[model samples]
Target: MRETLPILRLLSLALLAGVSLLSSVALAQEEDGLDIGEAPVIIPADPADAGTLQPSPSNPAGATPEVDGDALELDRRVRDSQPPVMKGGKISPDGEADQGINIYLRMGTPLPELPPERPFADEPDDAYGAFQRGLFLTAVDKAMPRAQLGDPAAQTLLAEIMSRGLGVKRDPKGAAFWYGQAAQGGDPAGMFKYALILMEGQVVERDKKKADDYMRRAAEAGNASAQFNWAQILVSENPGVRGLTMAMPFYEKAAEQGIADAQYALAQVYSALKDVPKEKKDRAREWMHRAARAGFDTAQLDMGLWLVNGYNGPRDYELGFRWLSIAAKRGNVVAQNRLAHLYINALGTSPNPVEAAKWYVLSRRAGLKDVGLEDFYLGLTEEQQKQAIDQANRFRRG
Candidate 1:
C-alpha cells in the first residue's frame, strides 16, 4: 500500500479536477456540492423548536407567549429583498467590495468641492453626422474646414479620423490634441474617449487620477456606459473588502436607463444576495429577462439556470431548456453542460438523446469535458455516435 501511494495521489488529483469541472454545470447551493440533479433544500425553521419568543420591545410588559409572527415575517421579508453583494465576481452576501477605498475616504478629514462644470462644444456642420453614418472621406474633407475654425465636434471627429487613419494619415499626437480640445469643451463623449486615451497613456501622458475624475464627470452626466465602468473600478473580489454594494446604486441607475450590461449586473447582484427579501426576486427576474432578451450571453445562461432551478419563481423546464439551448448554441460552456444534464435526465422537458449528444459534443469543443461527454456517450447508440462524429467533421469544415 505504501508503494502504491503515489499512484493513488495522482488518481485523487485527477478525480478532483473532473468533479470541479462537472460542478460548474449546476447552480451552486449550500451543502450539496453542486449537482444538476438537485434543487436547494429550504429547511423551514419551526417556532416550537425555536423555543419561547421574546416579547416585542415596544410592549415589553404584556407579552403574548406565542412566537412573534410579525417579527418572523419582517425578518423573512428582509431576507428576500437583499441583493447579493459581490466584488470581482466572488460570491458574498454582504457588499464589502471597496473596504480600502471606504476606509481612506473615512480617514480623510475633508472632501474637496467638485470642479466647475465643463461646457459643451458648439455643434459642427452636419459633416460629423455624415462621418458617423460612414461617409468618411467626404465628411473628413468638410470637417477639416470646420476644425480649422475651432469647432469642437469637428476637432474631435477629425481627431478620430486621424487616429484611425480613416481617409487621412494616422497622427497620434495630432489626435491627442484634438481630443483634448473637444474634452475641454465639455463634450461628454469626448471626455469619455479622452479619459480612455489618458488611462492607456499611449498617445498622451498617463493620468489615473484625472482619468477617474473625467469618468466621474461623464457618469454624472448620465452616460450609461461611463456609470457602469466607473462602478466597476470601486468593487473588489477579495473577502472582507466591500463588494458590489458600492456599485449597486450606479448599476441600478444605469439599468433603469436600459443599459443591458447594467441590467445583467443588477440581476447577478440580487441573485447573490440570498439574504434579501423574496420580493426582490421578481425585480431580479425582470432585469435578467430584459438582459437575456437583449442577447446578453451571461444573463441568458443565468436566467436559464433560474428557470431550471425554480429560483425566485416557478420551475418551467420547457422555458428553461429553450433558453439553455440558446445559450449553449452561443458557446456558453456552463449552458452546454446544463443542457446536457437536462437532456440526459429528461429534466423540465422531454428528453432527446440525439440533441443531448450534439450538445455534449459542442461542450467538449468549448473545452468543458466533464460528465457532459461521459453521460452523452453512455446515452448514445453506436449509429448515433457515428452521426455525431460525421456532423462534427462537417462543422469543422465550415
Candidate 2:
C-alpha cells in the first residue's frame, strides 16, 4: 500500500504539469488568436529588393514563440473581409474630416511619392514655348537675355510680361520702356502697345501727337487695331469728305479683318452722311449686317430696325425678328421693346400676347417708357397676365 501511494503521487504531479502547460498554451492562443505551434519566421524585403523577403524589424528571434497579436488581429480582420473602417477619424456631413485625429491612418506605413517639378526655360524659343504652355516664369527667364540684346519680339514679349505681371512682378514703366524699344525696332505690335501707353499717360508721359504718330506707323504696318484707332484719330478733327477720304482706306482695311467696331463705324459713316449715293447706303447695310452677325448688340438692334422698315434693304420681318430676339436675349432694352412689338403683331412669328407682355414688362422694369406696350399689356386676360408675370419673375431670378 505504501509503494502504490508513491506511484500515485508521481502520476498526480505529472498530470498537473501537463494540465499547466496546456492552460498556458490556451491562454496564449486566447490572447493572440494565432496557431498553438511556433510561428514561422518572416523576413521583410529591402526597399530596393525586387522580390526577396527578410526579417521584419518588429519581430525578432526568441521574443515570443507566438505570432504578433496586432498582426494576427489585422489578418483576422482581413480574412473576415469586412469593409475597411475610416481609420483615425470620421468624415462629417460637410465633407470635412474629424479635427481631433488624422484620417490618413488607413494610408498604411509609407506615404506616396510627390509629383515631379515643373520644367524651367533654357533658351529663347523655350521661353516662348513655356509662355504658350502658361509657364510664365520660364518665359521671362528665356526672353530676358534676348530682350536685353534688342530683339524686337523678345522686347515685346517682355513688355507684355511686365504689363500683365505674367510669372513676375508688374512694372508698367518697364513695360513702356520695353514697348518703346520694340517700337523703335519697327515691331507693329510694339508700336500699337506703345501708342496706348503714350495715350494713357499713366505709365509714361501723355503725348497724344506722339501716340497718333505711333498709331499711324502701326496702321501703315498693317495692324488691325492700329488701323482702326488711326482712322478715328484722323477723323476726330474733321468728319467731312476730306477726313473720310483719309480714313476710309484704313477703316476698310480694319473692317476686312473682322473688327466688329470698325464694321459698325463704317456702317454709321455710310448711313449718316447726307446725300450719300444708293450704293453707299447699300454698303452701309451690308457692313451693319456683318457687325450684327458678330454679336454687336447695337448693330443687331440697328440692323433689325432697318430690315423691318425696308430702309437700306427690303423689308424682311423674319430676319428682323431673329436679330431683335438675339439682341433682346443679350439684355438690350431697345431690342426687348422691338421684340415685344414684333411678337404682339405676329410680324415674323405667331402672335403670343403672353410673350409680348412678358418682354414689355421686362423692358418697362428697365425704365423704358413705351405707351403702346403698356396698352397691349393692359389688354391681356387675367390668366395671360399671370403667366407673363410668372415668366418675368423667372427671368428676373435668372
Candidate 3:
C-alpha cells in the first residue's frame, strides 16, 4: 500500500534556515511500515469492501433461483465443505496439513526450470512512435510480431493502442489480455494499466483485490503512475480506515519522481490538513510551494491563498497575486473568485470596482456564481454598470 507524508507539519525557521527541506517521501517501505516523520501507519482502502463495488457476473441479479426453506437447507447440506487443513500427524511444521509432504526427501520440493531470457531488444518497433507518426495500422502490425514473440513492451503498446482506439476499433477485452500478458512478464506499466481496467471494471469483472495486488506490484517496481494510484487509494479517509496521515510517504515518493499530478495532489493534501501541528503546516507549505513552482493550477491557487493570507508564513501579496492571476487566467474559477474577493475587500490589493467587476464577471462566468459583484455594480448609474457588465460579459465569454 502507498504511504503519505504529513501535509500539516510546522518547523521552526531556525532549524531549517539554510537547508531546503525539499525531501519527498517514497512509496517503498523503510524499516518499520511507517512513512516519513514517524507518522502512524494508515491502512489502504479495500476495493471489494467499498460501497461502489458491483455484483460479480457470476452472481448476476436474478441468476440464483429462489428456494423454500426446506430446499435451501437441503442444498446447504449437499454443498457442505470441510477445511483443507487437518491437525494431527499430517500437520506440517508451519501449521496445518502439508500438501508438499515428501517421504523421500528431507527438504521441500525442487526448484522449477529457469525460463529462457528474452532480451529487451527483441521488442518490436515502437508502436507509440508509429502511432505518433499517424501510422496506426502499421504500428499494430509491427506490434503483433513482437506480441507473438512474448515481448511485454509490444504487448503493452498493442493493448494501449487498442484500448484507446488509436488505429482500430476500441476493444477493451483485447486490451486487457495484452496488458495481462505484459504484466505476467513483469512489465510495471502493463501491470498498472491492467490493474486500472480491473479497478474500473472495464470489459471484464471488477476485482478490487486483484487490482490492489497488481497496483502494489507495479508500485514496488517503481512505476510512477502505479505509485501515484496506490498512494491515492491509501491516503483516503474512508470509514473504518485511518486518515491520510499515513499515506504521505507514498505521495512524497511519487512527487519526488517528478509526477506533476502527484505534486499537485500532495500540495492540496497538505493545504487541507493545515490544522495539524506547526511542523505539519511547514511541511505542507513546502509541498505546496513545490507544486506551485511546477505550475499546477490547484497548487498555484492554494499557494496564492497561503501567501496572501500568511497561513504558514509571512504575507507576500505580490507573490500571492501573481500566482492567483496565473491560475485565474488559466481558467481556474476558484482563483478568479479569490481575485475578485481581494478586489472587493481590499484584503491583498487596492479596491478598484472596475477591476473587481472584471474578476467578478470572470469568476461568475466560470461557474463561481458571485452575486455580490453584480449587486455592487448595480449600485452605480445604469449606463456605467451596463458598460462594466458588458465588458465583463465579453471577457467571460472569451
lDDT to native, each model: 0.58, 0.63, 0.57
Off by over 4 Å in 1: 1-26, 30-125, 141-152, 170-172, 237-241, 274-281, 372-376, 395-398
With candidate 2 superimposed using the best TM-score fit, by how many Å does residue 388's alpha carbon deviate from the native? 2.5
lDDT of 1 by residue, 1-398 (tens): 00011112332233223322333333555322223643212111110111111111111122222222221111111111333565644554455674544565789756568799889564335675566555666666676665555555665676676666655556667777766765665555556567767877886788978877876786676656566555554542211124456666767877876766667667766655545467764688889899888776666776787777766566777888888878767767667777877887787667777667766777687676675468658767899887766765554311
Ranking by lDDT: 2, 1, 3
Which residue ranges in model 3 land beyond 4 Å of their true spot?
1-138, 237-241, 268-283, 293-295, 345-350, 362-378, 396-398
lDDT of 2 by residue, 1-398 (tens): 00011112332233223222332242233322111121111111110101111111111112221222221111111111222234334656665556544434454545557699888553236655566656666667766666666666666777776777665556777778878877876777788778878876886778878888898998898777777667766665444555665676777788887766567667766665555577776798899899888777767877776666655667787897888888888877777887888888787779999999988888899888788789889888999999998998787321
Error of 3 at 314 (Å): 2.6
Off by over 4 Å in 2: 1-130, 240-242, 274-281, 396-398
TM for candidate 1 is 0.63
Better of 1 and 3 by lDDT: 1
4-115: candidate 3 lDDT, tens digit per residue: 2222111111111111122112212243321112111212112111011011111111222222222111111122123235543376766656655343244666756779
Model 3 lDDT, full chain set? 0.57
Instruction: State the weakest 10-residue window (summed lDDT) of model 2.
Output: 46-55
Q: List TM-scores for all candidates, in order.
A: 0.63, 0.63, 0.60
Better of 1 and 2 by lDDT: 2
